[model samples]
Target: MPPDALELLSEKGSAERALTAALASFQEQVQAVPSLDLAAVVEAAKPAFSSGIAFSAQLVDVRGRHKLRVIVMHAGGAEVTSEEWADEVDDLLQAAGWMLAMLLGIPLAKQARPVEAEIAEAECLAVVGVPDASAGPEPSKKEDAAPVVDLDVALEPLTPQEIEATHQRILALPQASRQALTKAFREHFQVPRNARSIGDRITQHQHAAFIDHFLEECEEQSLDGAAAPAEP
Candidate 1:
């Protein structure tokens, strides 16, 4: 075999090994979060590589809520340096693990603080080139913030049948549970108790979270044997 051909084969082998190790590390880190669905991670976490960069994607589920996260890592630098690329890959994987934990509503493990610091350092490096190692962190610029608006104004109204079904489901719950859910719904939408139809209060976009929270509360009550008395 030609020397050039052997060199190319060796580079390819090294890239594969690096990618495999990075993926294993990612899996271990993610699985440490108790709330993350391991089955979903196994099914959705696939790694792809192109042009000396690695990409990974996964759909993580927490308490029946699903979130998809994609991570990209560039292993190669301006020069052909394997060490630089490997370090970059490790940094990205650690950041991705922290991101997934946050998305799933899991608190970050204490050891993961460095990942956040590293991400902040990277962002600073991008904006200011080499940062002064001795200087304290610079104050971030404050920009005018946009006023938040109600989401219901933008959401499409649910159909009559959907509204009716939702009303029926709410009514089927015990009186105390129903009242609690109704109070939550009113507070969430800032709707007057008697001002809007059930359907109007719960738009299509808000329906899933509304119902899921309600069901979770109901389950908790049931497990505790504290279900409210059903209304006649």
Candidate 2:
């Protein structure tokens, strides 16, 4: 978890009592973590920016008392299997929310009351990684002046490296599946007449998701005892 990466955070629960109410206080952004549409997946190559957090919880009986146990999932997968417990429901939720934020690489400035978990003093105070004072000079104000920026943030456009990587992954498919994927790409987009047209078509689409879906379909077809041809 890179401390400042917050793409999308969603909460769904197994128990709907105090647990559901607690999760409701949390928030969500962008798409669902486990399942997302094409629009939501745009520029999602970086795992930090694309990961999702899901919190599943259940009530457990310890001896004769009940406790709330929260299980957290990152990017649709459970990162840790250890149990985190809370005696009271609200206290449990606050701690869970704090943990969720921490997993996204952030710590809350106003942490909740003292729990059995060690409370670090730094967590209550702001922890600055790079002070603004350390940043070089501020841009001079002039009509035509612009801040110096070495890289364009319009990174939504696919880079050559990403395109080449996708192309290689697509080409790694079974020859028949690879050919079918190329054909699908052509049907979706017009390809120019050239020796490298197949590769070019794949590059233009810049859609690794399509290939992943194709591979999934292949797996399903294999399980069904028949080879399935990928559809565009």
Report the number of the highest-TM-score candidate: 1
Candidate 1: RMSD to truth: 25.1
Q: Mind giving the per-residue lDDT tens digits that candidate 2 earns over 1-232?
A: 5534432222222222223223223322221222112122222212333335344546678887765454444553333222333453334544443333322222122223333211222221111111235335742222122222234432244544454455445433433344455555555445543222344333323344444444544444444433233469
Off by over 4 Å in 1: 1-156, 193-199, 224-232
- Give residue 169's error in model 1 in angstroms: 0.4
Compared with the true structure, all predictions reach lDDT values of: 0.41, 0.36
| Candidate 1 TM-score to native | 0.28
lDDT tens string, model 1, 68-107? 4544454832111111122223243443433332222122
